[model samples]
Target: GRALSELDSGMNRVQAMRSYAGDQLNRADRLESDMKDQALTQEGARSRAEDIDMITALSQVETQKVGLQAALQSYAQMQKLSLFNYIG
Candidate 1:
């Protein structure tokens, strides 16, 4: 009779341990899913930021090109004028 009672108690302990393990597994799975979602969101934002940086760099280069062209044209026009005429 004592052996039978011991077996029953052991079985109950095992069942409780199993339930606790299952709950822990479910919590870990949810955390893994949330981490994956967060990783994707960060990846997308980084891609967009890189694209914007590239666009900004291209626009700056275009602006410099226009400014350089204007300076060259102005110098060419200045060459046609005599220095003495402006000094008089």
Candidate 2:
């Protein structure tokens, strides 16, 4: 009867250990899911901040190029009107 009682106690300890292991696995799964959600949310926010609107940026670039070309032409014309060329 003592041996049988000891066996029951051992079985109870094993069951308790199994329960603890199961709880740990459940916590790990919840943490993994939460991390995945956080990563996705951050990625979306980063895209909004860093990604440019192609049409607007392209338009601004085109406008600046045109302005630069006009400025260069004006500078060249001013250089032609200098009196230093004739005095050389």
Candidate 3:
């Protein structure tokens, strides 16, 4: 009878350990999912920031191109109005 009681106790201990291991496995899986979600969120934010920067850079380039064209036009007009033409 004593040996039977000891065997039962050992079985219960094994069952408890199995249950704990299963719970830990489930927790690990949840943590992995959360990490993946966080990484995706960060990547999305980075992509948006880069897109905004590119748009701003493109706008600045357009503005500079316009300014350069205006300056070139003014320079050409000045060249046409020479001192030699005015004096002679």
Candidate 4:
């Protein structure tokens, strides 16, 4: 009976250790998944920031082009109206 009890105690200890190890593995897996999700979120935010910057830059270029065209047109009109045309 004593030998049987000793064997049973050892088996129980082993089972407890196994359960603890399983729990630790599950915790590690959850942590790894959370990290991956955070990384993806950060990447998406960075991509959006870059896209906004590009769009803003494109809009500025278009505004500048419009201003330049208007200036050229005004210059052309002034050149056509010379001193002789204005005086007469």
Q: Which stretches of candidate 2 lie over 4 Å from their true place?
A: 52-88
lDDT tens per residue, model 1, 1-88: 9999999999999999999999999999999999999999999999887778777888999999999999999999898687886786
Segments in model 4 whose C-alpha atoms lie over 4 Å from true places: 54-88
lDDT of 3: 0.96
Where in model 1 is the C-alpha error above 4 Å? 53-88
Tens digit per residue, CA lDDT, model 4, 1-88: 9999999999999999999999999999999999999999999999987778777888999999999999999999999899999999
TM-score for all predictions?
0.56, 0.58, 0.58, 0.59
lDDT of 3 by residue, 1-88 (tens): 9999999999999999999999999999999999999999999999987778777888999999999999999999999899998898
lDDT of 2 by residue, 1-88 (tens): 9999999999999999999999999999999999999999999989986897989988999999999999999999999987898787
**Candidate 3: pairs in clash:** none
Candidate 2 residue-wise lDDT at 79: 90
**Ten residues in sequence with the least summed lDDT for candidate 4:** 48-57
Off by over 4 Å in 3: 53-88
At residue 35, give the lDDT of candidate 3: 100
Between the candidate structures 1 and 2, which one is better when assessed by TM-score? Answer: 2
